[model samples]
Target: MIRKLEGRTWKFGDNINTDLMIPSFALAEPEEKQPKYCFSANRPGWVDLVKPGDILVAGNNFGTGSSRPGAKVLKSLGIICLLAESINGLFLRNCVNYGLPALPCPGVFSSFNEGDIASVQLEEGKVVNLNSGRVLATTALPNMLLEILAAGGIVPLLEGKGLLDKAR
Candidate 1:
């Protein structure tokens, strides 16, 4: 379901853990307000500057930390999608559960400079080089999570299907 997310690209090297995504201390705050304070502990000003549909590309190991179930920060940060060389399996699962598409497409970091336009196809596992119009690298997104993503987050779809009757 992923395609071209048109916006500025923020580039990072590697080992971008959850601490750099959203600090643990901020987890106490409500989810909607988290984005305004995202990564403020490490990068300070980058999150506030992020515009909707902007893509984040990192070399490897993006979002490796305690599984904090909040994509609200990432969502509010206006990140359309994340392309990384690699990602923590737990983060991958937790993120998508909250409606975040954490994809893996290695080599894009090497090919693209900051601000280069790119496109990600979840079905193909290929990130197209919009600048050069070439394919990047193939990767995998877990099958179960893909299903959840297709449903536009787990709870909403469940509620729509009348599968969340437990709350009532």
Candidate 2:
């Protein structure tokens, strides 16, 4: 994973949960077909608007529901990373596990609007709004977690070390 990421923003509000991201009904679909149903419950046509390398900027309690592999679906939708006022613990872990860089950035939600550009420096824990020239500090991920993300999540890291059977 690149330590620095820059992309267009897609703003969402507080308490945006896992169900809103990938509804239970969509779970039955094949993985490749699942991205189309993302945000179907609320933002009905949101999936169609997302472009590859877009960044999701959301308000507090982002990803506040079940452990439903929501990060994977977001990544599939071409979201490069997530920047939120706060992120749920389990969801943060899931993002790392799925190779998505999610930062808990205080004041981020107010700094950028939809379609604004955001630049994130992961290692430095800094978020800058390119459009408005605003900058916010984020809670940085530890180096160990960064390594996991860089290696494309824990499973791949272990596989590369021959610690687990790759065929599985």
Candidate 3:
């Protein structure tokens, strides 16, 4: 898996649910077009400002809502990884399934301001603020999850092992 990620941070508050990331209306749009609508309701014009390799830092209960493929949209929008004070369990799985690394660091919300550079080491469960030289410990992902991420998600992992039919 990708062991490390360093990127500019995008700070968000608590309860950043699936609806905010990918509105119900956006889901009906083409997959490639859906990302443009991310955070459109709450952070108008924010999606346009996001750059590839950016990291999202959020407060508690991040991604707490319906299973609407929000994680896929975030990855498509170029967010390489997510650091949050807390992440909803279902959403966390979705993130992994979509090949987006997400970690929960208890104090992550206050660690950086928007635009600060942050570095994350997934397996090590470490987060560092490159701008401030502050380090935070995160909940490490499991080895199996890391393997799935390395293969670009569970489907690919299974396919590689010949456990899934490619035709399907």
Model 1 spans with C-alpha error above 4 angstroms: 1-6, 140-143, 165-168
Give the alpha carbon lDDT tens digit for every residue of 41-110 in model 2.
8788899999999999999999999999999999999999999989999999999999999899999988
TM-score for candidate 1, residues paired by index: 0.86
TM-score of each: 0.86, 0.95, 0.95
Count backbone clashes in candidate 3: 0
Please rank every candidate by lDDT, starting with the best.
2, 3, 1
Q: What tens-digit string does per-residue lDDT give for candidate 1 at 1-168?
A: 544445567887887777666677777777676677677766788876778888888888777776765355677677877788887787777668777777877677887788887777776676776787777768657777777877777888687788887757
Query: What clash pairs does model 2 have?
Result: none
Cα RMSDs, all models: 2.3, 1.2, 1.2
Error of 1 at 111 (Å): 1.6
Better of 1 and 2 by TM-score: 2
Ranking by TM-score: 2, 3, 1
Candidate 2 least-lDDT 10 residues: 159-168
The segments of candidate 2 whose C-alpha lies over 4 angstroms from its true place after superposition are none
Q: Model 2's lDDT to the true fold?
A: 0.91
**Candidate number of the best TM-score:** 2
